[model samples]
Target chain A: MEMKSFLIIGMGSFGHHLCRSLAENECEIMVVDKDSEAVEDVLPLGVSGRVGDCTNIDVLRSFSIDLFDACFVCMGTNFKNSLQIASFLKELGAKKVYAKADEDIQAKFLKRNGADVVIYPEKNVAEQIAIAASSDNIFDCIPFVEDYYIAEIRPMERWLGRTVVDVNFRARYNLNIVAVKQGENVIPIPGPNYVFNEDEHIMVLGHINDIRRVAY
Target chain B: MEMKSFLIIGMGSFGHHLCRSLAENECEIMVVDKDSEAVEDVLPLGVSGRVGDCTNIDVLRSFSIDLFDACFVCMGTNFKNSLQIASFLKELGAKKVYAKADEDIQAKFLKRNGADVVIYPEKNVAEQIAIAASSDNIFDCIPFVEDYYIAEIRPMERWLGRTVVDVNFRARYNLNIVAVKQGENVIPIPGPNYVFNEDEHIMVLGHINDIRRVAY
Candidate 1:
């Protein structure tokens, strides 16, 4: 496996988290921020840090922005700073730039400024939570594609004690049981003989219309 | 579908997003915050809003907290206020309570203080971006179950022009192609005879180890 390298600009809550996650992935990372304290906070992650404002072309250039595999501009709530840094990184020839945005307007501007992708952390989480909150049977749900959702849901009362083959789940409900959660463990791609239990939660893939019909 | 009712306290970024999402879900929502400007910001969503300090039990009681199907405490960085509101909501007999936290310690305290669920929006999004950044083939991914991810990935060069049955995807890769992304549309649960094209992205469900092996 090849070790990827990354340059992350900013050290706000989102930036700090991105740094930690990249470190866990064992990627070679260089973090930058104007605040000396912010730079110091991520030192324990075993990554290099520079206490300098990335909005300055010279400061951004000094890091050889083009050399990193990808660059991330993570300024929380500061659309101006994020845009400036993202544009500078692209101007300096950074390969792939990811920028954080709070909403659609910021996301559009960031993309226009040369961001390869815009991450909407709060919006995504909120949507996921909203789906879970709207339904009593769904424990958690993440948007899969279009109207489809990958939902962790309680088994229907009729499904209890019935084997997967016996229920013909895919044909009858138009849903795929991807995994079964029993206590602390998740059994992925269970065999056809696997029986639905009252205490277990099943992770299934299906359209929202179908899921709602069966879930209730 | 039954209309769900929500009481969201604290009009921060997450709170606003949640309110917007719940409104889209057609749920009855009531928003609250100490800042009148924050309260005014969400009035356009067709939901009721109140500017009051929820940490004060008297102000919280005025809302008839027990009437809502669920309550959300969404104070950004104000752990004290969130804990106070969460505890007060549970005491007021709110059916369910969800609270937002930035880290594990805050999450633990919120859970202990009567929050039925704790959300880590920043952490979840950061981890998701980290995975995408670390891999060259994965466009986006979300954690599905233990060590498993539902990833939108570029199809391998060799798989182009092959039918789903021709490749025997599930048996060969131990990965399930849940959906096919063709342009802006996603075809969910594609038929066995569906052909793989170079321009399309496939959303697959599999373990990290299996994904890593095949994605490259």
Candidate 2:
């Protein structure tokens, strides 16, 4: 695979993390921050680093934004700075722009201004935790598509000893047991003969209504 | 389902969102914060609201902590306050406690202090976005269990017009097409004969390596 170049602005917690993750994936990165310490922190990641206030168009212009495959505006709390940088990146001909927003309202404004994608971390995580908390058996839930969800849940008593084929999972529960979580090990796409164990958590995919019917 | 009551402390963005989500799910909730305006913001959701510094044991004691099914500490930035409140909740015999943290280090400290679950919102979202951004075809990816993941991707050219059974998806690809996304509609658990289309995004469940092989 070819290496992708990324230009990252802001070195707050979110920016620091995004830089580290992209670097681990072996992407070529250039990090920028107003504070010298912030820019210095990610320099060891072996990418280019710059110290400048991104809110200033002159500082942004020095970077030659069009060279990077994508530009990330990762100011965690400064909505105004993030918005301004996102717009500047677009105006400078960055191929793609990703911005971080704290909530839905901020996401809309960021998209309208310049961001191709707005990542709302807090709101998404809050909703995920709430779904897990509100349920009796589900440990975690990820929304799939529309009303469908992928959920991690404890097996019901009746399913403890039965194999996937024996129980006819899809016909009986309207859910697919995509994987089985046994302690720290995850067995993906378990065979039809895979037996259900009491101590294990089953990762299933189905409509929300079907999941509720079985999880409850 | 029987109504479950929850106690939420710290009305930061995460807390505000958690409170609103739980209320929408019809769970009884009591929201607390040091700022009256923060508490008042969630009151319209018909939840009990209070303004008090949770770091004080006296203020926490007044809430009858044991009566709550679960307690959530939603302080966004103050690790000290969140650590203290989490320990206090456990000492007061709160059944379950959930706390939010920015990264792995804080998550560890929060869990050690008495949080039953630590929600690391920013880190989780950052990793997720990195996965999507790093790939060429994958639009989004969710870590399911161990090395398995649920990914949304544009169907391969070879897959268009071929039915699941015709391609022998499970045997040939070692992946499961759990759902098909066509525009806004998601057809979950599509039948074995479901045909792949060019304009549609397929949601597949597979090991990281298998997903990478197909996605790239």
Per-candidate DockQ vs. reference = 0.57, 0.57
Candidate 1 per-residue C-alpha lDDT over A1-216 given as tens digits, one digit per residue, 9 for 90 to 100: 698999988888889999999999889999999999999999999999999987789998898888899999888867798999899889999999999988878999999998998989999899889988888888888787667788889998888999998999888999887778887687765757889999999988888888877766
Q: Which structure among the candidates has the greatest lDDT?
A: 1
Please tell me how candidate 2 rates in CAPRI terms.
medium
Candidate 1 chain B weakest lDDT stretch, 10 residues: B183-192
lDDT by residue (B1-216, candidate 2, tens digit) is 788899999888889888888887679999999999999988999999999999999999998999999999999888899999999999999999998887788899989999998888777777777777888899888877656778889988988899988888888988887678888787765768899899999888888789888988
Q: Report the alpha-carbon TM-score of model 1 versus the true structure.
A: 0.88
For each candidate in turn, the interface RMSD (Å) is: 2.0, 1.8
Candidate 2 residue-wise lDDT, A1-216, digit = tens: 898899989888888888888888778999999899999988998888989999999998998899988999998877898999999999999899999887788899999999999887778777777777888898889876656778999998988899988989878998887678888787665768988899999888888789889877
- Backbone clash pairs for candidate 2 read none
What's the i-RMS for candidate 2 in angstroms? 1.8
